[model samples]
Target chain A: MSTALAPARTGSDERLTGFAGEPLDQRRYRRMRFIRRFEETLLQLFEEGALNGTTHACIGQEADAVAVIEHLAEGDHIFSNHRCHGHYLAHSGDALGLLAEIMGKEAGVCRGMGGSQHICAPGFKSNGVQGGIVPNAAGIALANQLSGNDAVSVVFIGDGTLGEGVVYETLNMAALWKLPLLVVCEDNRWAQSTPIAANLAGDMAARFAAFGVPVREVDSTDVEELSAIAGEEVGLVRAGAGPRVLLIHTYRLCHHSKSDDERPEREIADRWLVEPLLVHGQRLDEADRRRIDDEVETALGEVVATARALP
Target chain B: MIFAKELGDTLRGALTDDPRVVLLGEDIADPYGGAFKVTRGLSTAFPQRVRTTPISEGAIAGVSAGLALAGYRPIAEVMFGDFLTLMFDQVVNHIAKYQAMYAGQATCPVVVRAATGGHRGYGPTHSQSLEKHFLGVPHLRVVAASLFHDPREVFSDFLGRDEPVLYVEHKLLYPQHLTLPVNGRIGDLLATSEGGPLPTVRLSAVPVEDCTVSVLAYGYQAMLAAKVIERLAMEEEIFAELLVPAQIAPMDWAPVERSVAVTGRLVTVEEGADGWSWGTEAASVISRRLFGRLRRPVDVVASEATVIPSSKTKEASILVGSAQIEAAIRAAAR
Candidate 1:
């Protein structure tokens, strides 16, 4: 019985000020921080036996969702993979619905049927299986193209998704048909318990380039830089420039899922230095960062409280 | 009308009527048409709506699902029914689950048309009655093209549905003319097509109540059973009722139950492999429905479990034909 407050100020509103006169960067940071806290809360819920089934959290990868989703227009479509909470929250700002869905409440986004991975909302969708939804995303792109709509389709995949054959199949069709598809590969360098080295072979960018789709590769945790790059890529796709691939080399700061981290502690400790929150928070005023953190925690508190109260 | 042409006309009509209706397949465009020629003249008729895809069955079905999710009714053709194995994950995991998984918020009105059954020595890969594998999948309708039914109506009806449909087309039936019932009679057999949406065509040499065995079949096998029923009546003097259901999955057992109540015996024949098939499920259901009323236990006639060979004689020996249907019907009578 919870009512949504307002659409998250994540979109490029161009008002220069966001959410009570704060800068857009602060809003971006707040969104990312909210997603981070949201995922962290899910882990705590799992420990408390409040949730059943498994959830793939985008704990360290929140910036990818916040950075890329800002460029999408109203009619544009987004297809996300298993690790989708960050993308879903950034795209629809429906944390209460998502939490309710994962909690198996009837008030959930999909009426508690889709749960975490198989969520479907207006202009947004996510499936748990790797690479299976790629062709679907291409199809949506084709639909937009055929209808003469300028809306672009964006699909997010992990480094492990490259191992699926359907990804290549969709890439070939998307490139040949000149569909407006932006494939955002969030290369977190790991697929569950297995490292990318053991799973993926050959070059990631070359795999996309070989399909004749344009590729843009960047390794950064700073949301501002990623946002700028994503804006350019998304604009190119919207202009009917065929499919574009933005391969963001990022890291998974949390376990693949609940209580399943086999990664060495030292490797994880080093990644903490370049984590998106720390890198982005460095540029914001100390008082402003604290205020944003406090606001995110307060909002997430209501989302969780309302979700728990739902039938 | 020719079966394939009627289907083509139906596609043309759907494309013309709704801009959201589209066709995607391999070699389905102007020059090559399709593998079975069912999509012939479609690409030329509706240039933007019809598209030829690469040799990717998974993508063809998956993309069609995507189009359907986006409010377009897309009909994707998987060159041959055997290639549906490649599309299993997409159809079963994604397309079929989308509606229920998303709690009815999204509807995938996609039609996947594939040419199935083997008569022209298509061997293992090209010829397969794989419809049984797709049965019992939630939110998916398995409808077959039969000579007794108008395929134009079938395709049009499939386009009208809010659920996904696997439109099964027998390869051999594509070239044959559709033979509708003449005043409810096909020669000596009385013919009637019943059920709503996709239909179940009933044929009997005698009054359905007086028949000794109720024969069940679908697609090309059903058409063959109709011919076999006529011969069985004229030659052997054994009366049997044949039920040809176009919609196999989510089967409407009303007609089947009505026929079996009086007939007391049932025989199911299909072109797919013997066990774990359409025949098996029908037998299981019919037996449970009529436990003591049946005169004899239900029987099944189907292809052998071996991979279909390329040689003409070898393939003929493996697939179900009129002989198998006649023998199964004769056996059921005793």
Candidate 2:
């Protein structure tokens, strides 16, 4: 996988390009764009008195969730961490329902009992605890593997979750049983205020490789490449190839939460230059980009309207 | 029959009958049939279903919840009750909240079985009756069996009920002889002896009258309470009724309350630490509900509120023994 931090030659401009004309690509692009806009609007929603409780928004890291989740079948399970708006929205693709949940309305997916951190729908489960979902995902995979079914499970975690012991335990069990599961670590460089360098002890890939999981690292900003890798690896896992780790390198363009104001504005600005949205959309024509933007805007409008209309 | 043998048989029977039942825990299979042998010969009977897991308490909990969500009834043995401190987040946050949080879209039908109580010198960490830690958690059930209440029913009734449960077992009660009730009633005051998890088996004193003090207990404490009751009846004619509810937390207060109403006194006993115990819950609720009728402030008999010691005498001192239970019963009756 390319480790280039600078945005690469985005993609060839032809519709016949291996990554562009595919229907999956369009759906992924739409969902990623929707997640970006959805999280952006959350800032305004927070500015107004619309949402209760805090949300760890995944604005810049949308590609990691969308890329893996889009390739997964509807029956496949996705367990998530606290940075979960993008994963739930990507798997279920229901911004209105998610927004309603945030607004505490009855029409929400969980009848508003589950807020942003615990947005659980069928086939998509997320809780607020870090590293808690790893073993649960392994168990879901165990069910599929035991029943001799092809329904795989994918878990999304941050580089920070490496501190939790259950992650290693789940990794060992997943490898031992040959459970069809993939662990996607979206290494967004920071765990709240702590940098990965200070927190990490040894090599990340070496740790997973010791557990016998096939490890692959990718540049999260390259959506097309990330999508292709996710598709291949998810297929491999579903086919009983045991567990794999997709260590996607990412950088968040926004604060960890609304209250997190410790980050330098200049560093965020520098990171946005290589944002997945700008890099991935480089190949889309003015009309294509405009159309995606229009659909996202219209969807956001419906979500906000529906959420506000609810008592 | 031995109470622990009954528990093992009940697990084997569930494995034979239900395809959805899956067992997960450390040393749960083959030569090691769980730490307490509560699952002996299970792997031999059904090798595919019984799985041995690493010492991942958190994962054991999470995997059980996940398995339940995926339509498998999992019985995860946590080896010792004290280890629940590690993985209990999955229980409290995920397993307990899944049904209510998801608005019934999901249900975690998992039973976590652990050996509890302070005896046989298992030391502070190993020998603790920790039902108090898990009691009153929403959407979760706490079930413990004494010499009277059989573990078989607990496994059969709750191991696959689309709700998460903590099934507690005591280390000392495994070898003790137990009598299985053919059928019984809770109390005379209850409208019916039947429905709900609070089925009480009342052992009437010889030439029984309106009972004196009602001794409320479960697990090994119930066994001790039964002994104290029998001794009190033999010697002092105290005539205290013993009420053991099958379920501890989400407790059904009607049976205990009715007994308390008839007796006008309550003595609660348990092996857990004195503060924040199931006995404490019983004493408090009964005191508040039956304040006017209560003959005295409810007497709560429980173990010491400090770390359980490894020394045999010290362990016995910390344990709520039959002597303390009998004293409490006598005081409540007076």
Candidate 3:
């Protein structure tokens, strides 16, 4: 029931300390770190040309995926956009299938037909499409409404996706029908090298609020904070409070994809401002941070070894 | 008897029978009912299951696909077949490719119902038999019901299957009623007659059992072919069996091949423009496989290769009818 927007604490160390005091378990932190490492390895693979097609690594924006996924039940659904590796991993999608999909192998989630752009997990009934999954998530939420179930549908979109007409259309319908849906905009300053100022005009949170839907903004780097806010909002939706929007402020650390090499100073400055992993890691003590880093490296190393072993 | 009313009753019965079934479309509710009245009284009968949606065709199809993925058998209506173009992406890319693209991991068991064909004078925008647009999708089923009984039956079958279905209904034939034989139950239609007991019929010098002419006629065209056969019976003593293919894509070819074997000739009749239509594809398939059994070349009776004319006289002239089918049948017979 708390509608108070937590003020953005300055300094990575202070933010991390604040998050550590919150209720995130070590296992969840380890998982978030594992996603960051896995994404870093994926970027390396893409650099070596081992993986085909475009890869949108959620390198810096790990907290958004981790936090939002923590609020979802196993039966609830997650509809992800193209930049979905973190979301997919956080939602319990298979690592081997994710790697195989990136490699365009038959073992991939989409059977190599969709490459990394459209991987889906049948078990969870959760899937990822480029920009097409925006309206699709609303449709799924509508289904949950018709079924009269408390299952909440979450749609993860980047700042760039707000430009799409379908996304707004979906948001309007979700609000109009008072459907149980959570629209999480991972506002990672840059949408494929384009800054939010250059692309999006006007305030994003206010845009949804104007449509009569409650809107909230949070720091995407703090997993514990993000999880708390997301969990409360999801609960409200389940209680028939209608659709809500969470504009999570995050950063995309890497270049848009392997193809883009434009690492301008402005981009680097923007990345440093909201470096999600660095900011989240800085909060823990030196020993705890080192332990988390080692665990993440080992886990990612096993995944890389397994992916390489595939024939 | 399985008349149009019975068809609606059967659909209502099936909806009430299954918890997974849900219906959505324009004017599908009670009072005004559907435009064709096929879903009459369904909304009130099953208030929770049957829903009337806004006139957003793309959203209708997309929602159905999503619901199907979420384990619901959603039967969505597009009001008219011509409006299907608006949801082409949802139907062809999303619903059709779900199973194939996902490597059989997921299935979309959604059924899309649309009233197709000309004769309502709704002109080009409203009237079109465009099921051919969905012909070769890997994991989709295209079922057109010419008779009233088959709609409920085919719909029930589609609900049980794990593939998406484009269930096309002809607007012109909705009023043309056909009576079910005595002792025939609604359950009989629900059963997929795949490779069932073959009908014994005499064909040109040979006593054929199960032949496949791929007599690819759907909706009103199928009824027209049957009428043509009736007229042929009166004019000549020749008994040319008509194969009305209720299921087109992922076609149940066993019955069709059985019908074609004895006849050794394939004749297709369709109301759509001839080029690349279902009739054309059926002709090609028959000619290729049944070439050895065939005594003569395959013949196709379809509408002229032009847009549907607006004038009644021009429309009648351009549209292929029983006479053309009769001529085609005779040509293939010889």
True contacts kept of each: 0.76, 0.68, 0.31
lDDT of 3 at B121: 63
lDDT measured at residue B157 in model 1 versus the true structure, 0 to 100: 83
User: Where does candidate 1 stray beyond 4 Å?
Assistant: A1-21
Interface RMSD of each: 0.7, 1.0, 2.4
Give lDDT: candidate 3, residue A133: 65
Residue lDDT tens for model 1, A1-311:
11112235354221111365557778788888888898999999999999989999987788899888878777889999989999998887778889999999999999889898989998899998888899999989989989998998999999999999899988998888999999999999999999998998888899999988989999998898999899889989988899999999999989998889999999999999999999999889999899888877877888889889987
lDDT of 2 by residue, B1-334 (tens): 7877888898988988998889999998988788888888999888878999988889888888888889899889989889999878899988899889878888888899888887789899999888888998988898887666656666667853778888888888888877545444222211123344436655645422457878788888777777778777777777888877778888888878877888888888888888877777787888889989998888888888999999999998878888889778777777
- TM-score for chain B of each model, two decimals: 0.98, 0.93, 0.87
In model 2, the clashing pairs are none
First chain TM-score in every candidate? Answer: 0.94, 0.90, 0.85
Give the C-alpha miss distance for residue A163 in model 3, angstroms.
5.3
Highest DockQ: give the candidate number: 1
TM-score of chain A for candidate 1?
0.94
Where in model 2 is the C-alpha error above 4 Å? A1-27, B182-198
TM-score of 2: 0.93
**For model 2 chain B, the run of ten residues with the poorest summed lDDT:** B185-194
Model 2, total clashes: 0
lDDT-better candidate, 2 vs 3: 2
* CAPRI accuracy category, model 1: medium
Residue-by-residue lDDT tens digits, candidate 1, B1-334? 7888888887888888999998999999987898778788888888888999989888888889889989999999888899999999999999999999999998888899988989788788888888889989988999888888887678778877789999899888988888877899876789887877577889988888779889988889888999898988888889999998889888998899889998898999889988998888888998898899889888989899989888999999989999888888888897
Q: Score the docking of each candidate (DockQ).
A: 0.78, 0.66, 0.37
